[model samples]
Target: MTEMSSAPTVLVGAGNMGGAMLAGWLDSDTDAGSYIIVDPSPSPTVQLLIDKHGLRHEKAAPSDVEAAIVVLAVKPQMMETALPALTGMIGDDTLCISIAAGTTVSTIQSFLGDIAVVRAMPNTPAMVGRGITGAWANAAVSPAQRDAADRMLSVTGPVEWVDEEPLIDAITAVSGSGPAYVFYLAECMAEAGRRAGLDEDIAMRLARATVSGAGELMRRSDDPAETLRKNVTSPGGTTAAALDVLMGGDAMQDLLTRAVAAAKKRAGELAG
Candidate 1:
């Protein structure tokens, strides 16, 4: 368990993901005073937390206090624009946790020299606290510091440590960009339901709930997803009938492989 109250967390850019983390921290054992959020146009989530908890909200960098943990939550493209102000708050020992996709450790080190940094790639589903994050730490981070990063990341959902920093791109491709794929699956399923003449709202509700419920089941159960899938899919059943067309030519697999490759390419471009 992480001692959330022991050290203050400063988050830069309370956008979708950063705000989700702030919400999660608010619900955690962490003290309200331990949290700080920085963003230009704060979203509804940020506003709600500020009004309810009186959590620290600043339009720019907070200078009065030095944070034990600083989260760089701005987008990779925006980091260059927003990072200089953050340097003032980064004490020699302050641990930096960056959720900026495609912003490498080297890139951040250039902005904030020698401050320990842990790079993380987390998906959008973290908004609901069902997200998983894959993180990488540069050699400068202490073992204890890395552990701290893992626990903090785990607050959103599951956390995995990557041995190679470049693997963050793979993580981006597989998981960071993975949520959209799941969402699209739900959309497609709903559309298919509508085509089958079900009412539009009912079709959408069924698709969303079924997909979400299956994901929850996978999360809570001991059995593998394949096992659960097979359990529901009877021989020559409706699902199996659909599977025959979808999986027969390995169509879904091939399409997803291409999609992941495209995501990986874009990740590289962003890193570059």
Candidate 2:
């Protein structure tokens, strides 16, 4: 259990990712009373947590609040309106962490002045508390504030801090968008199974289960994924036969390399 912080933590959104973090914090040792959720329309899940924990929920941002951390979880599109309204929440000691994609630290600093800022990119898996966040903090952030932000984000998953802010786009290209690529693999595998005479339902189930099980194994084992693949492949086995086509001429590697490159390029464009 995390030691509870007496100072309030202002959460500016209550959507999927935001709601997941909120739920995680409430379930942990963090004081339930320390949260202040600011959302015009809170999701049922978020509202339920608020009611059950006796947390504060306001339709509009409060001007008189002095919070320890101000989490900017609203969508990038809504940030223009949200930042201006929530500027008062950024006191001298407050640490501002923005989870909104494509919003740079400079933009946030412009709106809220030179307060400590941590910009983070958290993926969809955060909804299940299995996400990994790539965070980058500006020079103004203190060590204590960095630790505080890390503890807060750990409720969702591990935190990977990078010194170069631009590397976040690469992280965005990889883990942030990586889940969809895995899902697409499952979809492709299911279709291939159907073409191979398996029932559509059975094929889909097999594909989904295989992908998830392999992911779990990778998580539990210290072995690298390449090593795991080698362990499964015999001198002349069916798995090797399949890998021959997949790995032949590095087809899979080349495709994914190009795909991630494109994603990173687009991320830079969006951020600009």
Best of the candidates, lDDT = 2
Clashing pairs in 2: none
Cα shift from native, residue 183, model 1 (Å): 1.4
lDDT of model 1 at position 264: 91
lDDT of 2 by residue, 1-272 (tens): 22334578999999998999888887775567778999999999999998888889999899878788889999988998999898778788888988988888888988999999999998888898889999999998888889988988888989999999899899999998999999999999999999999999999999999999999999899999999999999978999999999999999999999999999999888788
| TM-score of each candidate structure, all chains considered together | 0.91, 0.96
Q: Give me the runs in candidate 1 sitting further than 4 Å from their true place.
A: 1-7
Model 1, residue 65: what's the lDDT? 71
> In order, what is each prediction's RMSD in angstroms?
2.1, 1.5
Candidate 2 wrongly placed segments (more than 4 Å): 1-5
lDDT, candidate 2, equals: 0.89
